[model samples]
Target: MHRNHELYEYLMKNSWQMTEDWYKQVDDPDPNSLYSTTDEHIINTLKEQNQDYFKRLHKIFIEQEEVFLKEFEEWTIELAKDQKHLDTAVHYVVREFNKTQEVYISYLQKFYKENQDKVKLEQFFLWLEIVRKTFQLSIYIYMEEAQKNTSKQIAAQKEMINELSSPVIMLQNNVGLLPLIGDIDTARAKLILENTLTQCASLDVQYLCIDLSGVAIIDTMVAHEIFQLINALKLLGITSTLSGIRPEIAQTAIQLGLDFNSVRTTASLANSLAAFNQ
Candidate 1:
């Protein structure tokens, strides 16, 4: 209806005022939340962001639904990736979003009340539905983007942990020590193989001693990967020494018919070090 444009203009004028009112009414108790931030700069940024959201929301009255939603999604993604928002609890963010939607609905109700006779009841209901639907869509988009950002951060952390866990400690000239611990899954074994080869080359190490005293268990696939690493090291012209081959692991190697003739074997890490010094 023609009144749609009138309502849009009305909301547009009150955009910054709405932000101020909503912020004043915000009652966040959690100190960890973005809403609870006391920094003047952060508060100003939050207000600006809220005003920006209102600007985008009001555009629905004039813009095509598809176009509006696309721009809304862009705004959602930017807010979702914001470090401050990311640091805040997701539930708190959603709570604030719902609160903001309530504020918008109240404003719409006020506008409808002011022109109760001119705007039909059905038109008022339609406008309310649009506001609610748009807010719901924004929330859905925000959650998805936040989840994706979290996944990427976790993957990066895992990579750092993997690199740290599989360190190739340089012992002396052209020699390094790799002490593996805990269970060796196929995935970790593969990481070790790749990481070790790269480190050996970078450090210009001609010899590597791999100690397995801390390793409690390894599956068949992991054992195969370890052997594959040794073979890889051979191709790189690096000699490899295996130490602390637990009886269980030794049995697995024998059962698998693994050929250990190509690499040096030692009873313990100390023995390997002694051999290296000889």
Candidate 2:
């Protein structure tokens, strides 16, 4: 513990230089990195964060060596859950964090070289163990938190796409137009059903014209989902018309044994809109 305090005192006094060197490396980073594009405010915030960390770290290392990991935990979690860091690419952050680790190891080596008489072998091991464990734990939490944030962003994007793809435009009083384009998969088909119904209710649509002119093909299940969507609309008291269903989709609907005889359909969007006037 005596040697631990000796190393700690040395590090406490040199923490500012160590932190400054870490930031110097982080500033220029890799050429293709997000760090290169980061704003000045964020850079300043990062510097302040590092300064706070070093203050806490120095005190813990010198006064309560056994509690270093616990003392460092809040700082680790703050970095992990931080929106700015989470928004940056994971690989870029990892590269910079590894560089910071290198800075520490180098600082320790420099310390040993200048003060060989003050350092013991076991003291070196204690320093190494604490640095390695604390930083590794921080890295693990950072990666896990970033992955979770990414997953949430992806899910939110998919939902926005679904809402955008299925749109109901009001053509007249109590009438709406829904134009569906692209290939229909099970997931997309489900979105179409949900969004169309919600839009109809929101628009107070009594009749809806569904145009599928851009759809080239759809599987059997997708066809069934569309047919089911028509029936569902009927329950909501909305008159639904289908148009521009390609021949392949028709065949697939037939193969699925779907009964659409009662559902209204037209050859094109023009014809469907014309039928509305009559």
Candidate 3:
């Protein structure tokens, strides 16, 4: 139900040729990129994907624009999420997209030249606009999905780091050590609370020695979170002993009116360990 049926058929029939032509021109010197891969299987698969992409692109000339775009976007999103493409630098992938668009435009021009008597210059320009817009939409969708996947991976990595940073290492039967170091932001404090509780419960720790010797600063909110963690552990029947509480931290706790009298305290990790291990 399209006026450009002849052009659509022409492109569909030559999809493979377009893919081959596109790949032959690929000249990326970057050794880290999939574009420069020497693997035969990957090269073949890349050509297949490119051909499939062109086939879908040509459908826009024949199918309803809405239908074509919805299908095309799905393909682009899946390609964006592909590990090979994700591992490759984004700029390289986008450059390939630009090159592919040029292939389509070149093919369209060829078609126009062969049918100059039937295809007006204005009609050719209109088709060129459609080609450019479709490529733009595809690129936008790909970049958006790629960013979302990258963000998800980063968040997962950050969670892992938070978990590792707040580890509760078992030193003896029913005893564990949580060495607090560096800055304790509110976010990290909350993570510490959750991770500590889970680790303590899993390790069946009865006494947890929280060493704060390396920590140089603690804000009011973070200090509150630490207290909450202590109380939470208390509810779990785990006794928490504060060790190496720095002078500045103690001063902050005093200013905030925090009651550390309820929990046992030690001047250093060694003293706490000796007391708990005894």
Candidate 4:
């Protein structure tokens, strides 16, 4: 009975609960204790009395094992996923460190005694230093990569803002320069107009120059936008000059019949600046 109590306590600590029959099975009569039944007979009676409890305990044990196995499998999968990048970094570090270790070992073997004890401590210290240095180097490489990625992202964001803002590049005090680059869609054209107008008002410039050397061709929508820009600039009391008229663009503008009669035109940026100076 005492042994049964201890076992029950141990089982409860390990998250195993028993049925009511458990107590009845361990408290039966025994002939060995100067009673009517024999000890074996008492034990057999207990087993018979608690058959259902034993069966339930067996089922619980099986379920607990299954639960532990499932959790272990899940943990393994998560660890595998998390370690992929770390594993690559470790591989790189190990490969580079091994090469350094080989060179150092070769150099040491030539000067040191050949016995294991003679160089074991020195080799251990050397390997420890190599590991420390390798860890530092790996950290440095990771930091460098992170910095480069951050720089690229910042640069991209700035460029996007500049593009959306349609920043006007002022060339000289007299010349209000707007160097058109890349494809100029209708939205971009509107941005260009707004930026130009803001710059013209702030600078109080008399001549506004539009350089189209970077532009490939003129479409109808872009041509109309250009015409609108000319009108908007005229209302702001600033004269707008067009430059870098590629022959293909000029031909396209003519085919589209984009009305540019009110705006002055030039062949090159240099020519426009020259005309402004005069």
Q: What tens digits encode model 4's per-residue C-alpha lDDT throughout 1-278?
A: 01123322333443222333233233324323311234576445434423332333223223454563455344323322332223333334234334433433333343334344544655545534543443344345544554455566678776587565455655566567778877887767877777778877887766788888889877998888888888888888877888997888878878888676777889899999898878
What's the alpha carbon RMSD for model 3?
Answer: 2.3
The residue-by-residue lDDT of candidate 1 on 1-278, one tens digit each, is 42378889999999988998889877887898889878899999999999999999999888888888899889999999998998888888888889899889889999999999888999999988888888898899889999999889889988898888999999886789999988778888999999999999999988899999888777678877988999999999988899998998778778887667776899999999888877
Question: Candidate 4, 196: how far from true, in Å?
Answer: 1.4
Residues 1-278, candidate 3, lDDT per residue (tens digit)?
23499998999889999999999999988999999998999999999999999998988888887888889999999998998998888899999999999998999999999999999998999999888998999889999999999888889998998888889999887899999888888999999999999999999999999999989888788878988999999999998888999998899888888778877899999999999888
TM-score against truth, every candidate: 0.90, 0.84, 0.90, 0.42
> 115 in model 2: Cα distance from truth in Å?
5.0
Which candidate has the top score in lDDT?
3
Question: For each candidate, what is the lDDT?
Answer: 0.88, 0.78, 0.91, 0.56
lDDT, candidate 4, at 28: 20
- Candidate 4, superposed: residue stretches over 4 Å from native: 1-165, 171-173
In Å, residue 248's CA in model 1 sits off its true spot by 6.1
lDDT of 2 by residue, 182-270 (tens): 87799999989998888888989888898988888877678778888888899999888998877877887788776768879998898
Deviation (Å) of 165 in candidate 2: 1.3
Model 3 misses residue 255 by how many Å? 7.0
Residue 12 shift from truth in candidate 3, angstroms:
2.0
Clashes of each: 0, 0, 0, 1
